[model samples]
Target: MGILLLKLVVGLGNPGKEYERTRHNIGFMVVEELARRQGVVFRKMFWFPARQAKCRIGEHEVRLVLPTTYMNRSGKAVWGAMKKWRAEAADTVVIYDDVDLEFGGIRVRAKGSGGSHNGMKSVLEWLQTKAFPRVRVGIGPKPDGADMIGFVLGGFAEEELLKLEKVVERAADAVETIFSVGTERTMNEFNQLQIG
Candidate 1:
């Protein structure tokens, strides 16, 4: 069989310490975990603010990315990285936090609407395609009377944080599985999992 081309894994999140450990940045957390496993450091790239590491997983070369742009403007980084790598949508996987699913859960999709995620919205807009795969980490629903932005940007509670670690690891595993077995197979295995 021919060698499979390199794949881009983009984790969407805002830049800065303020967003660190927040529900909105679970994407970045997943990518960071993957980076740790590969021993690749994320360095800033011009045009796209991302940490890039070259590593191989199950026979496929992978480029892991964590966008520096804030959640709403994530497309700028994603589009630039995709173009720089000459990667197609099918070869790109975006990891992001999802408010619609319960906390600690994960959902993988081949392609779909962004739902209500501004980060995914920006990526889809910039890429001009929704055909790419994505791993959605559940951050749970917004609390009653809570501002949606505040809710997403807030750090996870102690219990939530512990559960989040497992979710992040699972998300990374899913990414590796996608590269090894293709999205359909990975989705079948991961989408049915409940993280909490």
Candidate 2:
């Protein structure tokens, strides 16, 4: 069997400048890194409430999308992008923040339940599948006394912010690796790295 070439990559996050630097927008951050490395600019499309960029990694044509429908409605953007590009669940990848893992960690899964992420849940609902690829960037667990909403919406601490800079870059590299290699190989290589 051949690897499903990635046709679309969606970065799940809330839009607007207010949510720009929050932990919940790490997915957005990773896509920005990808855009920078690929020299592509994302334009807000009127058809979908999202920003999109078109580019190629080697011979694979790819679309990078950032959903603007807040967190819960992220699936609408993914659905729109998938439809516009004629991409299937197996040909798309979603990158987002994960609070369950330690900060600076990266994990790639071919398919799984959403776990505790409402964004992923929204995606599963709209796409109607548990078989797409996903790249999870850990935002660390919430601190004691912090509510889930507040913690995810909050900005990273200064020290963690420094570390996150590298993690974001690595996440971008991981996405590229998925296109160059394949999801399973990328997962095995990245999931074993010890990042803070």
What are the candidates' C-alpha RMSDs?
1.4, 2.5
Off by over 4 Å in 2: 1-6
Off by over 4 Å in 1: 1-4
Model 1 C-alpha lDDT versus the unseen true structure: 0.88
- Please list all clashing residue pairs in model 2, or write none if there are none: 103-196
**Compared with the true structure, what per-residue lDDT tens digits does model 2 show for residues 1-196?**
4553548988999999999999999999999999898999999999888999988886688999999899999999999998887898988989999999888999998899989999999999998999999999999878888899999999999989779889999998888898889899999989987566
Worst 10 residues of 1 by lDDT: 42-51
Mind giving the per-residue lDDT tens digits that candidate 1 earns over 51-158? 688887777778898887788998988888888989889999999999999887878889998999999999989989999999999998788899998899999978
Worst window of 10 by summed lDDT in candidate 2 = 1-10
